[model samples]
Target: MTSYAFTFPGQGSQAVGMGKDLAAAYPEARAVFQEVDEALGQRLSAIMFEGPEDILRLTENAQPALMAVSLAIVRVLEARGLRVSGHAAYVAGHSLGEYSALAAAGAFTIADTARLLKTRGQAMQKAVPVGHGAMAALLGLDLAVASEVADAASQGEVCAVANDNAPGQVVVSGTVAAVERAVELAKAKGAKRALLLPVSAPFHCALMQPAADAMAQALAEIEMRAPLLPLVANVLAAPVSDPAEIRRLLVEQVTGVVRWTESVRWLTGPGGVTNLAELGTGKVLTGLAKRIDPQAIATAVSTPADIDAFVAQLGL
Candidate 1:
């Protein structure tokens, strides 16, 4: 029997008007947005539906907002009798999407995940001052070469690999000068392209130590159960079942590189996962998964139409 993997997207996939169709069509889906809004004590759903673009793009808003949309889609799928627990062998998310995976796996309630992401977003946004840090994507460089470039560029400043997105795509983050130097070094080292990213904060680097510390404290107070399914953690790229281990990794992920390439390899190779279902707002993870493993069947579910197609395919 072929097994399934459920992958969730993180920050950048968020866009205005996400989940509105499901919310309108399914009462179960609409209830998810309502719960998140009440949990946050604000009209976050309104902002996601009718974003001023800037407000939704803010780190603080984007994290929880994306999670809410992802969960809403999950609810609609469940209401149609497609249970994630029965379908998925493993669940994983890119960066903050990990929280969404945990919620989907029943490790934490949607309410708790929303609250945690809100605090995490605010803490990460405040970690480094606005203009002090930066991130850059070094395209056409493998993880090893990208690491070398970041290390060479760091002059006692915090340049480090942030995201190992694919075979030839890696993102480095650190102090503005260090990141700038890394870009130049990558370009000089025969990288096909090295460009500065438009991200507001330098994420998944040593510069986020303060944010990591803050998350350590926040996660301590929350109750985390072992996920019903194993979660392939972002930092380690391995399936972890212990709740304590999950909490520790969540904190470490703040200042650690997202080993996405290694993660996908583990899932498709050793973990024996196939048929990846991207149960979130965007096709970003599906596209990346296909790039990582051309033979893998990756699906993206965002709206009512997507849900209908998926259920029909499964003969559910």
Candidate 2:
């Protein structure tokens, strides 16, 4: 029996025509898009299937749109008689993807998750002014070095580590000037690349505290049940099942570091997770899984063909 985990992707993984094929091939996927569209009071699926690029990439739209696709895949899987609780030992996701994981695990309904993510995206975007904040990726630098780079660059302006993505990949977020300074410092520190990201706001840093507060309020209004399976929370890099704690962590995740590298290590090491299924639009998490632990089998379940293959691999 193989121990399996299902992972979902976050922002930046959204594309122009995501989930079009699935919507065409599976009614489950179509209904998911419809449900999200109704929940958000917008036809986001059209934007997802035929995007104007900028509109679909808007944080509010992207967050829920991505979740819809992930949930669609989850529903399709369940329709195939392979449910997350039955097969997955745990569920994890990156940033906005965390809501998707919880939704899959039955902590929240699909419609509730969509509305929550929409609120989250709107709150996060509103937390910082457009030109005041930024995020940057510091490549070829480990977490310690990246932290140093962030610290040295912060001239008292809030530059801080955001995502510890992998062994040599870390993201820093803060004031634009501080992030720019961190890039230069990273270059000086021999980072292969230190480039500013095109994100709308600086996320996972103190600047996002306002957004965290907003999420705390929004999350309190929803009924959070314990997930069907535990979630490897982004902020803690550990599995957490308590609904109260999960709500708190979701709030903290707004302004806390995403311990992605450590989370993956914990899954492969102590959790003994051998298979990672990235069920979403892109191969982003699949790539991360391979980079983090090549020994584990990582599969991207996007297409109908992929769905069949994954089912076959599971001996269904």
Candidate 3:
């Protein structure tokens, strides 16, 4: 008798051997991994189970790898009699995690999502050359102040807010110079910490326009269906069910700020979701869920044990 919103982790949640255990424990999980491997025509599961660390961390691999783990967990949960249609109230994901959420809700198949994420990762990386772009985290600064700081620091470059993760954690992405300037301005504006992230591309900014264009073409060819459950889209921080709208939003998300704080607020506030089950590679979103809303019961279902326990708790 529990109603919860299912959330998926984004890029930074990846790790070595992310889905290895679940693959060993469940056939459905294993099948999901195999399908992704076939779709990408690469041994991505090997990288996920046994990584060279750096390769798996590549944006191209990381996007689908994270989604694969999430989809694997979703398949296992389905096998356990947990239907997203009737069991979960809504679904949301962080950045690339949105694809995983859509796949779980049947908006896209696992194979198609894998291919799209692979394309997305490659497009994003190709959009910006190495050392030309950067992203920085500005702690202890609200979105309004962060926006002001980014604008002031832009120096006529493409600097802008990329993610509003929480109340005071804002991330800015842009050319290296602009992001560096934003860091300095944020620190001077009384931020507790402002530091650059070790990311290859300045994602979710105007500079990613090329990637957005690529995704528009890529998404246009793919077949999208309405989700079984509504999705709290990143760009809107609101529920969307139309396939066409979701397609457009997915393209816009490439350069749009991820309104995660607002999305979580909608879930716990007006959406009335009490429990948050984060199904993915790491507990990154789980931690953020509590930070975003203390009263929400956030659980990470990343392992076979976690899935077993969660399914039982739900009376499945």
Candidate 4:
């Protein structure tokens, strides 16, 4: 039996026709999409399956679309008799992927997760005015050095680390001028590339305080339960199972750094996660997991064929 950690991708992973095939092939998968559409009270399914690209790419649309696809994949796996509660030991996600992990782990229903993400996306976008904030990736720099660069480049603006994706990859987000300054400082500090990311809003920074406040109120209204399995939280990069702590972390995550590199390391090292199954649109997280821990078996199951292969491997 494989002891795996199931993870879902954040933004930048969604694509047109992402979960359409699975919906076509499996009723279980179709039901997941239907549930999400009903939850959001709209035809987001149409936007996801046959997208205008621009509409689907909107932060509000993209968050729930990605979660729906991820939950669909999980439903397919469950239909195949591959129970996550039985085989998986831990669950973690990258950024917004944390919501997917929570949905998968039974902390919330797929409908609730979709609704929450929709609110989260809209809040994040509305928090900062366009052209006022931005995010940039600092390649070839570790977290400590990247933090220093961001701090030095603040220039009385709100520049801070947003994501520590991999050992050498860090993303900074804040006021546009501060992020640009951070880019220059990172380049001067021997960063291989300090490129601005094409993101709609400055996420995961103090500038997102409005979004955090929005989420705090929204989450307080939602029902939360302790997960059956541990979740490696984004802000802490550590396993947490308490419902209240998870809620607090979710609010913090809106403005805290995503410690992804540390989260992956925890899964493979002290967390005892041996296999990592990525349940989402793209294989980006799988690729990152490979680079993060080569010994960990990473699998991507977006399509029906991929799920079939996974079931066969599990002898289910």
lDDT of 1 at 70: 85
Q: What is the lDDT of residue 303 in candidate 4?
A: 88
- Candidate 2 displacement at residue 281 in angstroms: 1.1
Candidate 1 per-residue lDDT, tens place, 1-316, comes to 6888889999899899987787889898889999999999989999989988899999989999989988888888888887887888899999999999999999999999999999999999999999999999999998899999999999999899999988899999999999999999999999999999988899999889999999999999999999989999999999998999999999999999899888988999998987888988989989889889988888999878888998897778
The TM-score measured for candidate 3 stands at 0.99
Q: Assess candidate 2 and give its lDDT.
A: 0.94
Better of 1 and 3 by lDDT: 3
Looking at model 2, report the run of 10 residues with the lowest lDDT sum: 260-269
* Reference-based lDDT, residue 148, model 4: 100
Q: Write the per-residue lDDT of candidate 4 for residues 84-203, one digit (tens) a residue.
A: 778789999998999999999999999889999999999999999989999999999988999999999898889999999887889999999999999999999999999999899999
Candidate 3 residue-wise lDDT, 1-316, digit = tens:
4579999999888889889999999999899999999999999999999998899999999999999999999999898898998889999999999999999999999999999999999999999999999999999999999999999998889999999998899999999999999999999999999999988899999999999999999999998889999999999999999999999999999999999999999999989999999999989889888999999999999998899899888999
TM-score of each: 0.98, 0.99, 0.99, 0.98
Runs in model 2 lying further than 4 Å from the true structure: none
Q: If the candidates were sorted by their TM-score against the true structure, best first, what order would they fall in?
A: 2, 3, 1, 4
Deviation from native of the Cα of residue 70 in model 3, angstroms: 0.3
Model 4 worst lDDT window (10 residues): 78-87
